[model samples]
Target: MYKCFLEIGFEAELSTHEDPELLELAHEMCNEDVATRHIACAELRDMIYERGECNPYRMDDVFLLRFLRARDFIVPKAHRLLVRWCNFRIQYPYLYEGVDLWALVKIKDAYEGTLLDRPDIGRLSIFRFGTWDTSEFPVEDLVKAGVLMFDIGIRQPKLQVLGGTLIVDLEGITLRHVATLTPTIAYQIVSLLGVTTPARLKSCHIINYSWILNTFFYLFKRFIPREFYDKIFFHGYDLKSLQKHIDLECLPPRYGGTCNSHAPFGLWLQKIKKYRTAEFDKEMKALGYLVKE
Candidate 1:
């Protein structure tokens, strides 16, 4: 599958060869000093235990490291993030319950395809809001599936280290589609991506926007974090403008790039299934995911 499934969390040192740049990133952005990282992990663990409120959370070094890195190794912020994540779990357990990636993919409205190439930034996932049909697929189901993708993605060290990028193609957005994102749903999305998620969101590219999309953002922009807002780019149907941030080489021909073509949805499902190892399933189970045997 991937060179290695998510590495088992323990006392292992960072590998020099996997992605040497990550060591630099860890130190520079995460304030990670190899000597003191364990101290931070332990401190975060102690903070979680001391509060005695967050349930079904992992205190392992690697698990704690994800939150720490996302918050720049600030122990208190990391603890806060970890607690918010735990509360999100308790608050919306349905999001994690029995996520059938196979079934989710079949919902035409909720199509998510992986970009075949993994860029230095991280793995890329593209979503077409245009494909969503509110009449058939409930918005909550879309959120349920989206959360599963995030949960799976954050477990991988490569994604955790390099972070992830998203391309949102809003080619056919309409008032009907915009209506699906109510204020509460919009707030949850903003909070999940901007804060609660342990995964680092390197960037989000919004392309092929229309006035409807603009109006929706106007109404809900306040819900988004300022820093996260800065990372979002509105390309407005200009793939060339998008090219400035993401190399054309990484995009597909549909977006004016030189990738052969997108893989079939079923193909991506097969690949994702490879990631569901015994250990991975166990961790997800502890987090209340209904992992099918």
Candidate 2:
């Protein structure tokens, strides 16, 4: 490694500790990307099953609660769901094991109209259902399972408060960190993805936000990777704060702003597979997702 660094002419001497700066350079590296990302994950699993005990597998439902609880979680209600999720996995292992990892949870079905609805369920119910954005069990149909409080909701943030909550009016939504969306809906999005979830976004919309935040909180980590600097993305249209906050690489402010000023969004689809553009022509050949840094 030292010899390679010397050849590349990097001045900083290699050290035992790879602080955040050294570990995260906007450069491509080995077989490591979202599709492969799993350090904290492996650690957690090992912690759960003691590494050699049960293979310390990849991801299980419990990882969701562990991640969400790391930041104290959103509200008691969100925690309530998490509790049910945990117990459900234990009491009904075979039932939980049938989850299709690739599919999104039917947000309405996965969480709505179930034991989760009972205040009697509490955090335990969430544990039983799972802290996972998507429970191993998909939501049941109304015929099989009963439900109540069908249309519960939260208020959407007003356009005027965009700056406060950091909502952006996008020409289109691809991916960016700063969004003024009623962040509360995080959970709804999470349930659908059936994989990663996100943390609760602080917002004023109470009625509906809780449902969404609890749903999608895990996915947030996917957007904000180990590289914090790269995580800095904001609304391109908010010119007043553009100088103060968002730094668009291309588009300026307003309709006359810079073209192609889009912030990177969605799955980090830098590989050339789907986007056969001239730029990705070579990357696709590599068959790996690159760190755009």
Candidate 3:
């Protein structure tokens, strides 16, 4: 058990309520066979390095384990998924390079949300999305902001191990906002969340969805894969229904939760900004990549 934790360099203590299936899977993949694990990790690393996907920053055992678990320990499938992730980062340098407080604030304002400190019962990180001023920024900026958040998320062992939960608050959304959901932007968002990113999506709750929003969502669904449709829950102004999936206590006051006197957007932003800024710089330096200022 300790060996498994050490192999992954997991500094955070495991949650008491961690899923048994995930724990069992981690143990089976990392702890069960030391020699076999090393051989397999070596093979995967060689494959990734040979393709120049991860050169200076090689994939370690713990990192490779994430790909393996994502693909149910299938080497070929995991390799393909891992390659996709690498390609996504390379293709979208703006999202990952030279991240700082200024960039984060812009992203936060563009998307109008933050990741809450407290997770759901399943230990998934909770992202609370507020009303976005769609007129303020381009659609691609919003997508880049979302991708940056996922980059921050995957750095955390707990979130990567368990997954993520999204709560989209559509209280102030207007027809203008809905109109921005073009097929091209919708495909980018769906593919980024579903295929490219390393974080697993546990659930997505869309609260306060208006009738007009439903039509937009219907059109938006066409871009996403059929399987992801099951993960999305549309709760139109039903706090009780939303609470069924996410505990009310974990939510902000605006969402009928008692966690804070008001929306804790500032708190979440400070936490993410403080923790991720330096790490993002280091990652860019490691990859010998830089973002154009």
Question: Best candidate per TM-score, number?
Answer: 1
| Greater-TM-score candidate between 2 and 3 | 3
| lDDT for 68 (candidate 1) | 88
Number of backbone-clashing residue pairs for each candidate, in the order shown:
1, 52, 0
| CA lDDT of every candidate | 0.68, 0.25, 0.57
Q: Write the per-residue lDDT of candidate 1 for residues 1-293, one digit (tens) a residue.
A: 33232222111112113356667766865677877889999898888889876754567887888898888889999888888888877777777766655566654434454444353546566777677777877888777766766776576565566676778788888888887788767766666564787877888888888777767676568777787877898898888898888776667778887654343343444555544556766776776666664
For residue 293, model 3's alpha carbon misses the true position, in angstroms, by 13
Candidates, ranked, lDDT: 1, 3, 2
- In candidate 2, stretches whose alpha carbon ends up further than 4 angstroms from where it belongs are 1-22, 26-42, 50-167, 170-186, 189-238, 250-293
Model 3 CA deviation exceeding 4 Å by range: 1-40, 46-58, 90-94, 97-101, 109-130, 261-280, 286-293
What is the overall TM-score of model 1 with all chains considered together? Answer: 0.83
C-alpha positional error of residue 98 in candidate 1 after TM-score superposition, expressed in Å: 4.1
TM-score for each model = 0.83, 0.25, 0.71
Quote the positional error of residue 42 for candidate 1 in Å.
0.5
- In candidate 1, list every pair of residues with a backbone clash: 208-237
Q: Distance (Å) between predicted and true CA of 73, model 1?
A: 1.3
Best by lDDT: 1
